[model samples]
Target: MDTITVKRRVMMPIRAGDVMAEFISFQGDRSGKEHIGISFEGKTPSFASHVPLVRLHSECLTGDVFGSGRCDCGEQLDEAIDLINQEGGYILYLRQEGRGIGLYAKLEAYALQDKGFDTYQANDMLNLPEDGRDFRIAAQMLKALGVSKIRLLTNNPDKARQLIMYGIDITEQVPTKVHVNQYNHHYLKTKADRKCHTMTFDD
Candidate 1:
């Protein structure tokens, strides 16, 4: 396997309503999408400690884009951006939509979910892994940015393993706080029950 390299990086202003941030785009070979997008709270060339607040957010077109209530992904993305805007950190927005199953497949899985199958079971019925996302690319992006130690903002423990495998040091695991509606409560529970996600909030 090839060690992912940063092909290009550019500093740009990012505005999410009243929340303003500066982000550096890390482009890889695949192009047209974010391999990694790091949004910081303050000015560039930060004087903060080596252990930065980092969030490895995989792409979720359904939730992150359309604000679908079927899952907590959109809420998580919004929360991550808001927190990073305050705390000063990097939100590595990776292009691993639907846990790497892509958009159309995820919609199909949603149909299966409506048929009473849970998220993982739906993926299983589709012959896909419950979670196909790989955080090694996130690790590589962190290394490229010269960030090794991080307070990883996530609930998934597998993210830690994948980063460790790629030599990234996780100083802390910060579980994401999300707004759970009736539509996503069971989805979140399925994550906690079947996928081993650490969920602290009551659903």
Candidate 2:
């Protein structure tokens, strides 16, 4: 695990209402990836509490920027912003695109998905790890933010496990809303069934 330190903090406003956001940068990240920590709090004075509700969101250009329905990244991001704004927390926007396989490989996996391969299977076909995200960075970010304990806002158990492994005291595991649609039904299913993400679909 890389030893990380707070490089800078910038105040910024986002689209998710009147929340107070402090974007953070880090130093000593071995990967040299620009991971950002967007901390939202104090907008609703009474909603702010002791323990922060933190979210570790990986980068997804296709889904987050273009609103692609092939996955729920964008929706989850939007939801995280709103919920974290209300509850008071941090959103660690990691630059781990396509589960750490890079954009092109992710696209290749997508091509394989079009041929009936599951997300993991497509990655396997590409000789790539199914999920190569390292949550140690997230833990380091939280530590830099002076947070040792958190109520994590995510459905992925792996996130919690990794955070715990990296010395983040997970006080609670908060599940995100399941965003399932025609374009991402199978994708979400693969996440739930194979990845063990906590997802319950509507009947």
Candidate 3:
């Protein structure tokens, strides 16, 4: 594993609902991009010996930031934050918008999904891989933060595999699920069926 040089650390605050989180920023390998780590302060230290409950959430501008109902990314993020606050953990907000296809391609995928194409098929049509995120940098960041193992919070199995492949010990897998809406039902199914995400529709 390569060493990550944290150029600087910045303290910032994010207000979500009634909760205000204090976060730290580390300048990552990429220039102009800083990895933000939300602090679970009190509860997190208790789980440090065990696997930290970590979440590697890819950037979802529409769903995460804009509260778009086309997917449950935003809801899941909120849930992760709340859980982490109580149980203690971290959220790695990767900038791999649209599963690493970037914003425009994700928008195109959204159009295709609207036209009845599932998420994977739409990305395939756009000549993009189903998921193009690389967790190597995440592993490096975790190492920098002194995290040796993690009980990851996610439905995506590939994320677990990728993190382990990059040498981060995965002690357990925790699933994150949100109730499906009319807009995101098939989209969620494609993630479960095609992407091998652990989400169950029965929930």
Candidate 4:
């Protein structure tokens, strides 16, 4: 595996609601593409030669940043932050937009979903991979941060397997579940059924 070049690290205060967190940023590379790492201070010791609770979360600018209800991505991100804050771990924020298919294609897929297609089927219609995200960059970033193992927080089992395949030891799996609404119910189901995401819906 190629070593990621850490261009710089900086400390900044992050304010979300009433919670203020001290975060460190590490700019690095994964498979030649730039990636960023944001680590929040936790109650537990940092990097004690064991796997930290790591959330390898992908970027969802529309849902996470803008709070768009088109999907549950935003809710999931908030949940991850809360868990990591409590458990004292790291969140590897990946820039894989639209599951690595990019924003334009994701928007196209959204249109297909509106026309009566599931998320996977919408990608299929667009000749895009159901999920194009690659976690190799995440692995590199983790190693650079001195993380050897991780209790990964995600609903997608493939994420766990992929990270392990990239030489990061995965000690446990943390499931992320969010309530679904009229807009994202089917999209979540498609992820569970087709993409092998471990999500359960009460409704």
Candidate 5:
């Protein structure tokens, strides 16, 4: 396990629309990841699950903040945020740009994808892992926040598997809304086929 134990640093109240939340920050001993937790107020809870809705969202600068149509990162993030705001849960925002390949290498891989290769092949061309991401830090963050079991919101199975390996019980899985565009259709296909993600696209 290469993950460092994270300790709770600060928790402050923040409001988004009618939703009130507590923004939590964690300090890692060695890991250099900016991990955070957003715990919204339980105004209208999801009694169907009887647990908080949790999402482990990796930071995608181009797609998340900039709304790049190259992928569904930003759109899925919006969905998770809205879900949390409504039903009250947590969103663990992890600083893993390009699935931990970082921003520069991600753009480099994108260049390769434009040259007629799928996402996995693009990473292979760049001498990078297909998905260089680790979810143990998210597990650590959840543990520090006193959340051992949750209803996970994600599309990638790896996220849920890794968290389970770290002992977080996944009560349910909330799939992210699929946003397929011409720019990211092939990319998403590669993910579903090669990465074992739970998605079916008409491609």
Candidate 6:
């Protein structure tokens, strides 16, 4: 794996309101995507004492920007900011939109989803991998930040598994809350059942 370095660091106040984070840009990212890291120093002594919390969030245009309820992406991003802020961590905002199938392909898959296909099924119909995200870059980002160990903040086991494979020491895995609603209930269920995401439905 090639070494990636921090290109820039700026104090950016996100929409989360009064939450200040040190936004970091990387140089020589193998993926050639404009991935970013948002760092929040741990406020509490207990949180600061532990390994940093980390979140590898893929890009979701519909969910993150427009607040679309079709998936939990937006809510998860928002939640990550607050949680990581309180617990000293970094949120690696990856540009692997739509599970790395790109925006257009994702929309096409969404059409299949509207036609009664499950999320993974839709991807299969489109001849795309069930999950195309690569966490090696995330590991590289952590290395650039001088961190080899972390308490990962995610429900997806693949994230932890991949990070471990790429030489990141995952001291712990923290599960995100299930943000299920009518529009995203089935989508979330498919993730829990098919993708093995750690989630529990109230229904």
lDDT for model 5, on a 0 to 1 scale? 0.82
- Rank all candidate structures by their TM-score, best first, as comma-separated numbers: 6, 2, 5, 4, 3, 1
TM-scores for all predictions? 0.87, 0.95, 0.88, 0.89, 0.90, 0.96
lDDT of 2: 0.90
The root-mean-square deviation over C-alpha atoms between each candidate and the true structure, in angstroms, is 2.9, 1.7, 2.5, 2.7, 2.4, 1.3
Pick out the ten consecutive residues of candidate 3 with the lowest summed lDDT: 41-50
lDDT by residue for model 2 over 92-112, one digit each (tens)?
999999999999999999999
Please report the candidate that would top TM-score against the real structure: 6
Superposed by TM-score, candidate 5 places the C-alpha of residue 40 at a distance from the truth, in angstroms, of 1.2
lDDT of 3 at 92: 83
Full candidate order by lDDT, most accurate first: 6, 2, 5, 1, 3, 4
For residue 176, model 6's alpha carbon misses the true position, in angstroms, by: 0.5
Compare candidates 3 and 6 on TM-score and give the better one: 6
lDDT tens readout by residue for model 3, 1-203 = 34675454444455634555556566547535455666564354553425568888888899898998888989999888877776766788878888888999999888888888888888889899988888887888787788878889988888888889888999889888755998888888877877788877875
Clash numbers, per candidate: 0, 0, 0, 1, 0, 0
TM-score, model 5 to reference: 0.90
lDDT by residue (tens digit), candidate 5, 14-127: 433444567777765367556777877655755843688899988999998799999999999888878877787788888999989999999998898888988888888889
Give every collision pair in model 6.
none
Instruction: Write model 6 residue lDDT over 73-166, tens digit each, in one string.
Output: 9999999988888889899999999999999999999999999999999999999999999889999999999999999999999999999999
Q: Clash pairs of candidate 5?
A: none
lDDT of 1 at 173: 85
Give me the candidate number with maximum lDDT: 6
Error of 4 at 57 (Å): 1.1
What is the C-alpha local distance difference test score of each model?
A: 0.78, 0.90, 0.77, 0.77, 0.82, 0.92
Tell me which residue pairs clash in candidate 2: none
TM-score for candidate 3:
0.88
